[model samples]
Target: MRVLVFALGEDDAPRVVQFARQLGAVVDVVVAASHLSSGAARIAGVGRVLAPDRPCDGSAEAVAALLASLASEYDVVAAEANSLCGDALPRAAAQLGAPMVSHVVAIEDGALLHPVQAGRAIAATRVDPLFFCTVRGDAFAAAPLGSHPAPIVPVPAPPAGDTIRLVRAAARHTDSGLTQARAVVGLGRGAANPAFSARAAALAEALGAAVAGTRPAVDAGAVPESALVGQSGRSISPDLYIALGVSGAWQHFAGVRDAKTIVAINSDAHAPIFEWADYAWVADLEGALPELLAALKR
Candidate 1:
């Protein structure tokens, strides 16, 4: 059997190739060179790699078309579940009239295992050969690199086929990767102001923590929406999470539910954040933060 993997983001080529290796011995991978390192060809089980000279912007359609065209040659065409794969693979599946299984956690007995009901249960799905699928990011470890690496065969940028094209590109501002941070400082409405947020950021820098925020804090521009921590935003599983001036509503709490330790600081004695916090400090943040920052600096 043979498989093709579309590579992007943290759900990257190596891990997806690790997943592909289970379905087939010959795992041929495709990657957006801009998003994935060419070093993916060196992974242990991979057979070949198709990468563009430049993973040209606005090439999602082109990549989807290419994967669809390759369907006949490979038993499975798959990617790790990410924004890019979530968009491109479905289009490939549509074009080829192939079944697409998403959020796959494992392959068991010729069927894919998917998480259901917020990951409380698993469902087994049997998809035919020549299908499209996306494995979840957490499904596999990266296929380790070895001394001998495969040759990186460059694929030309395919025509976007007169479909939607890019008129311009603007870079989005990025914060520290929240998912990989060991420690996180979460700002609620208490740090929504410029002065308060700045001090909180200083404290975060001292603690070596990434900064995330609640909706009100994001609305106040205390932190970007990308750093927002809530049910609607990114979920984090950090070793330490500090909540400041936050009222622990379920929506915000849901994102940090997996944190190993939670510390809450708020002036309001009755703030809901204290209810479930591992450590609670009922004190004014304006006074408390400076002391903490000073202590860390010292």
Candidate 2:
């Protein structure tokens, strides 16, 4: 099969390339960013690397146009399931009149396996040939950089008109802010109240930890969507993850599964989070938070 994999110098590129090779594909990699080095393409073990003449700063329309133009030549189009690729792939797929899938965890029996209903169940979907999709970065091992380097192919600049242009890029807190934190304090439904939310922030600050939240907390306006840690949000591997009032749903657990130590504080003994916690405490968050904060102060 002929596969075109999009790349942006992300950690997940090697893994996405490895997956393409597993399918016995003749892979062609497209570097979507402005800076191009043959080294990245060499590491991916592809024969050809296509790059734009000039670097584009996260412009979905230019990428979509490029991918749409190239879509007909390849049997499959794939990219790492990231913010940039996530937006561009769907737009490109729409241009080609092809189906698109996101958050793909695995490929089994010619079908894509991905989480559905917020990780409540796994769904296997089979798309028609010449489909576009995104693969989860953590699901596969990265391919080693090969000794041989691939040839670079430079493409012309995309047309500029009637497209949504990026004015300026703002640094996202979720990018390096939360992911780099050694300790993370995760708030859930119990932290929805203004009092509990403020306490959670104070405790996190006192403990020198980053504050994260579940989807419910984000939906309830307790925190921004960037602070959400779950299957649908940012995946982190912190040294310590303290989940407060989190029920331990699979979607939320997927993000913190690699934490060195998991500490769960929930009132319900049967809360699913307790099953995976290294330390589980059954206590009301309202009552327990103050005491915990006071003890920490002393």
Candidate 3:
């Protein structure tokens, strides 16, 4: 059987393709409508790649066309449950009359697994035959390594058709720093002040960490979009994630829940973020930051 996966550079390539191959299927990729930074020709374990049949405008249309092309040849199609491609999966699945499951965190017992209860629990679902799922980030443990490297082939552009027109590209900012950071400092509404970010930056620098913030903090202009970490923002799996004055909204916690270690500092001990954190610090952040920085130096 053939499986189609969305490609964006090499970041999720290893993980997404790994999952598809585990199901004993050959993997293919769908390219973006716009230009991409990386080419998959050299990547191993990727068979044929399918690009937009026609020059398209929106990502959804481009993906739809690719999925439609593969529907005849492949038994299933898969996509990562991420912001860019999340909406497309369900819609395409519906259009093709294919069964689909999203937010899949694991796969076992011939079924896909999903997390529930603010990511505190998991639920297993069995999809109908001839359907696929969108895998959640950090959901399941990776499978054993594979030795065979599949050849990648670029698909020729399809004939012109009425498609979503392309508009001027806008610059997007994300907290990519947190993705690879060993430590992260997350600020929230409680620290929603221009002054706080400066102090937070200092703390981050001293600790050799990257800076991140909750949705409210970014919305309040306390931090840039680049520092946002939440459901509506970037997901971070840092080794150490530190939250200062963050109340820990469910949306915010989902982004950092996968961190290897988490430390939350807030005046209220019952803050929701504390439930998932590894260490809790109940104190005044204004007073704690400077001391924390000083201590790190020693």
Enumerate clash totals for all models, in the order shown.
Answer: 0, 1, 2
Say which candidate scores most in TM-score.
3
Q: Lowest lDDT 10-mer window, candidate 2?
A: 165-174
- Misplaced by over 4 Å in model 3 are 33-39, 51-72, 129-132, 140-181, 192-194, 198-202, 205-213, 218-236
Off by over 4 Å in 1: 9-11, 34-37, 58-66, 160-180, 184-204, 210-236, 242-259, 262-295
Candidate 2 lDDT over 199-283, as tens digits, reads: 9989988989988889898899887665678776666668899999899999889778878999999999999999999999999
User: Is candidate 2 or 3 superior in lDDT?
Assistant: 2
* TM-scores, one per candidate: 0.68, 0.68, 0.73
Instruction: Kindly give the stretch of ten consecutive residues in candidate 1 with the minimal lDDT sum.
Output: 165-174
Local error of candidate 2 at residue 285 (angstroms): 11
Local distance difference test, candidate 2: 0.77
Kindly report which residue pairs in candidate 3 clash with one another: 45-150, 57-164
lDDT at 224, model 2: 66
